[model samples]
Target chain A: MTEPTAVIHDIGYRHYDGVRLGRGRATLALGVQSLRGVFGFGRTTRAKIMPLLLMAIMLMPTVVSIGVMALAKQFIMPYPGYAVFMQAVIAVFLAAQSPYLVAPDLRFRVLPLYLSRPLTVTDYVVAKLAALAVALFGLLAVPITIQFVGELLVDLPGPPHTADYLGALGGAVLYAVLLSSVGIALASFTPRRGLGVAVVIAFYMFTAAVSTLFYAVLSSTGRDDVAPWALILNPFFLVDTVQSALFGTAPINDEGYPPGIAACLILLAVIALAVTGVLLRYRKAAS
Target chain B: MTASATPCFATEGLTKRFPRVTALDDLTVAAGTGVTGLVGANGAGKSTLIKILLGLLPPTSGRASVLGLDTATQGLEIRRAVGYMPEHDCLPPDISATEFVVHMAQMSGLPRTAARERAADTLRHVGLDEERYRPMGGYSTGMRQRVKLAQALVHDPRLVFLDEPTNGLDPQGRDDMLALIRRVGTEFGIDVLVTSHLLGELERVCDHVIVIDGGRLLRSSAIREFTRAEQTIAVEVEEGQRRLAERLAALGETVAAQGRLLTVQVSADDPGRTHDAVRDAVCDLGLSLLRLEQRRGRIEDVFKEPVA
Candidate 1:
């Protein structure tokens, strides 16, 4: 006799299984997937090369500053000091490269592949932010370290405090993270990569212009002693403030900190909030 | 024991609405093991359904479950078990197939060593051999399609959704891609949900077929079930001269003459009888029969309306 199971012709048998999984486990799985997309395997070869090229270019200012300090034996340059120079380079690099790294995934529709996997929109945003942060840090770290070595070799006079170096490194990392988060949040608002890049650059330039305007107004009013404290709204200026505070330079403002420490906390909070909002918007748009 | 006893994917009353349009409108479909063809015109919700089933798009209403997991709620779990090849070219230009697929495999939780080994196996399975090491930017459309297919299968998901996998391919590339899709479902035992606007193409490869129009289900059935019904038989003869037609007409074969052939309708239950009668009439009339076969109903036929 033929097997009883072989003769059945029920149509409902074709129905698919309806299994549900835990969100935590799925989130972990997709987070790893997104992280891998950003960091793992051969995908990073281009990412690695681009940053190296950018870092090589960024190193020019640091190398020149070190050379001037070593050979000329003078701190005659009005550009503040080594810490300020390194911070400026980090700021400029973040302003220019952040959009390139984050905007392509949105423009090319690669985000769908990640969304189709076990990853959520927030996980995707975090992965991208992390990638950009790490890349920018890598780019900035190289030149900063080179400058540090140069300073050490030149026996720059100071109390030789380890905390100073650690603090400066921490400040650089914090500034990079904050700027990357802002870049990603801004880029996420538009799908066009050019528009995204333009917006990020414009944001940085606008902040700089406004700070210059405020300083001009203050200087023209015969208030040369008072620095434009409102310049803390610009992240680059904020980093300058933190650098001055750490290096014991003359306070740029009577308050010793422009916008006070409250502004720094607010900037960090605003960056976090902006990231969260963009992530939520992305989730909705993706769905 | 039924062939459909274990469906790889199923959706019930699935719906999706965009800002200006409803991309998917109350769509429901199910597919068992093997390849299922999802055929529809452009903007007919093919991509919408695939996206929903893949957990990329949350349905406006209703539910879709892939590999037995609810797409809306358990989408992450469902995604882990299902692979998807999107229609668009989204691969990074600088990455090679081996690297891309290996990265994807590792993303699916494969250890680094296993991911690399599986990437090679999957790439070879999709016919990307030495070229797997070349950057995807230099790949032809056909080669890119294979790379996308390899990435989908790298993690060994039980079900794979191929959205317009044959789109943008030349005729030969189309044939090769179709053959690969068939093998993915049959030889590899991986369930496949392949979508395309070309109905005639999928009819040849799909075990089951679902047709949608205007974001709604038009028809869903097995490939054979749709085409197995009795239909017109196309008969061609070298020299019938008028006698064969006259004899067949006298014998109550309702024959209609077109340039060099005759079309006769066969009753659903008596197709063989109709064929035998036409053969006998041709033989008796001394006409050399060149061709005689049932005229297969194309998927396009369902789109045409009958006028009263």
Candidate 2:
């Protein structure tokens, strides 16, 4: 047979098995591809440089917080506690940067390049979320750990005993995961990266502001009892509630640890639903 | 051309619908070996069909297959064997061609070492030169298109779908691209499904041609069938053109003068006789023969027919 004929025969035999790579293998390959894509490997240098720049920017708050504590410790007291400061920084970073990470691949039709490979819609979504979460953790972890060590060195009273470190780590991880999911969910609604960024920032900042405004109104009106319930309106507050509990803050008069846990559970459920919606939207957009 | 034992690509009643448009509607065509041109105007469903075959787009109705694998269920399998050069410019501007093509090869399941080797070979094949190491953002349109083609072939796919590969090229660039495409299909032994709006361009290279209009199949046949041998021969003479025409008609040939040339009809099976008769008649008439050649129908002629 001629070379072309031989190729045809080879293709035919290859097709007999139908799919050469099993589903599990294909999924794993796709996941790796997505990680490579998100990290900008084998793509444009901007893809490589942009993520680096974004991470650096995300870590900016850590540097700023550390500087403020070291240089002007007398004025910046309570230090807002490292957990609160780190949480705020992460919220801002996700609001500003997460959208850019996920939106462009779909908006610019770059998703076809990924989808054309063995990658599935779910794999792409998971990879993106994982990438953002990892970046967020890197940004938050270094500064928080530094601040924790610094506070110890200065012999300052910390928020919790050493016994609570594990719980605090768990709380931070939970918050990071939820934040990543929420950022992706919001980004999925629009293809425009700038718009996605703006929307996410607004979603995070606006809900937090509204929840605060509601609490202030309730407190001024002598209804401090109802402030904890009002906190449920904000996902960030749910995160804060968990942090506050980990730090052994005063429990709400009406409800105890179970309510805060329930609220966190509810927030997680929302994150799951939002993630599902995003994935479905991505799949539809791909098709 | 006789029917091959198996078709390179075949589709049946493929349909796809979007909210704003019916992108592909009951389209069906079968293509054999060599370069097959899928010609259609913009928004004519050419891209849609290519995407469906690649399993990028799910058909709302009907069925399709590539290399005998079902597109609906085994798109990944088909993609592994069928390369695709998309029409859009979506390259990451910062990465080098080496990195991009290697990643694509790896994506198609090649090992790291093999992917790198294939990437280098394919990039050289596309004539990227030393600029392959530079970022793609600074490259010219022609270079970008070549890079896209290189990545598509980096996996050594058996068949490839090149959508509007020459869309942004100048005439010379377009010619070069067409030549390269011909080499890929013929010299490299890869079956090519290339789409173009330029009918004349495909006429020179494609072994088969499939015309589509309004998301529907109009015609699909070998290029030879589209440009079949005509019974008429066009004759041009330096002098005695009128006398030559008169002599040809006197010899039982039906002839007509088209400007300085004469068109003579002959029996379909007697093409050699028609040529001899024309030469004899011109010589006897003492006329200087300028040109004598059979005229075949162009692919553009088929475009003039009503869509079926």
Q: Isolated chain A: TM-score per model?
A: 0.70, 0.70
Candidate 1: clashing residue pairs, number: 6
What are the per-residue Cα lDDT tens digits for candidate 2 across A1-287?
55554332311111111224443444455455555555566455765776566556655655665566566662242222344544455666677667766776666566777676666778678767877676565555655565556655544334423434444555567667788888888988887878987898888778878877987787789876786667666665576566656555432223422366677677778888988887888878887
Per-candidate TM vs. native?
0.78, 0.75
For candidate 1 chain A, which ten residues in a row score worst on lDDT?
A: A10-19
Candidate 1 lDDT tens digits, B1-308: 14655477788888788889988888777878788999889999998888878777678899888877777787778888888899998787766888778766655656667777778878877888898888888999999999888888877788899999999999899989999898888777788999998777787788988888888888888887655542678888888547777887888877878788787877567677878889889877888888887665555665663311
How well does each candidate reproduce the native contacts, as fnat?
0.31, 0.26
Evaluate candidate 2 by giving its C-alpha RMSD to the native, one decimal: 7.6
lDDT of 2 by residue, B81-141 (tens): 8888889886866567787787666666666677777787787777888999886768898
Every model's DockQ? 0.22, 0.20
Cα-lDDT of candidate 2: 0.72
**Distance from true location, Cα of A167 in model 2, Å:** 2.0
Best by TM-score: 1
In model 2, the runs with Cα more than 4 Å from the true position are A1-81, A145-162, A243-258, B1-6, B17-25, B111-113, B229-300, B304-308
